[model samples]
Target: MHQAIPYRTWIHANTRDSRDLPLAVRGAGVDSASVAKLVSENAVIVIGRRGCCMCHVIKRLLQGLGVNPPVYEVDEHHEAAVAAHLGAATVQFPAVFVGGKLFGGLERVMATHISGELVPILKDAGALWL
Candidate 1:
């Protein structure tokens, strides 16, 4: 009665068009200043890819904790530049930033949450009232 789509096909279908992306945004060779500006402005930011399961997990985790972080897709923004700027080139994607600072990726975020440090950070950033 129902058909299941392949993972790759689903990803392709959901991917944003390159033309829709902003001209100022770039991937690997992007400027670090732009990334810094973005991080410094947002209370909570998550740079990730739409098709990444880990990214989804990280977002959901934040939401579960009553925090709504802005998610920027790598395909739509200069994620590499942000990663390099944050000195997290080795661990990008689902990269978290709180209180205008790098909070690390999935592992770090999970560790912080498990250690009960994430809530205070979110509160400090004004991302969570509760």
Candidate 2:
């Protein structure tokens, strides 16, 4: 049987981990304790609408990647300014704020994911790896 879902569905019903390949491999690299400490101390704020497809997708993506950043709803009482600035002007849903910087919307997130930059970026921004 065939199933249908929203365009931005971040479904993982039958998906498996693609982590078999080396994700953090390096020929000659040194781990920095300071960076690790800094990352652990930061927080990521994800602004999104409750029913938005892209929003759901982004949320699921982050969660599946083992990162559980705090999620805020634009329609909620708090985070009004953030929602206003993101939605009123740009009509963007799922506005991700990493380290207090606007990280754009779902398209940007997809781009980052496709480009294989999301992991490191999220790591640096302290948004993921929970």
Candidate 3:
């Protein structure tokens, strides 16, 4: 039988300890702390899985609305960490942060857009022009 490497432990087994690696180095270039920091530093940012369709949809939607948010694509390992930091009830991909706050997922975004509040929110976030 063959064994597999545990997540975030893709480094060679001979390495002293995975903990020695920086948080960003341990996995997909993001730790929970980095994710939190990214949210706080940006007016708007979307943290989503690398190849997720919802991520694409969210990005396109924001662009269509004249808001270009920085989309940080994380791999699956980083996704769960980000989700927990985002405080979502479940794993929500393409988690939106507006004005340095969690703005929920795709459904919430769609609802806000339908309600005509997305533009105002984007304006407040400084992600869109007046």
Best by lDDT: 3
Across residues 67-116, which tens digit of lDDT does each residue of candidate 3 receive? Answer: 76666667776666667766665757767889988888899999999999
* Clashes in predicted model 1: 0
lDDT against the true structure, each candidate: 0.66, 0.52, 0.69
Candidate 1 per-residue lDDT, tens place, 1-130, comes to 8999753212121223522333122233344564566567668877776557887788789889987665655664555555667666475677788888778889999998999998998998998887
lDDT of 2 by residue, 25-89 (tens): 11121123322222233355455655556766777887777776544444443334444433345
Model 1 CA deviation exceeding 4 Å by range: 1-34, 76-79, 85-89
Quote model 2's TM-score.
Answer: 0.54
lDDT of 2 at 60: 82
How do these models rank on TM-score, best leading?
3, 1, 2
- Runs off by more than 4 Å, candidate 3: 1-27, 87-91
As a whole number from 0 to 100, the lDDT of residue 11 in candidate 1 is 19
Root-mean-square deviation per candidate: 7.0, 14.2, 9.5
Q: What is the lDDT of residue 125 in candidate 2?
A: 69
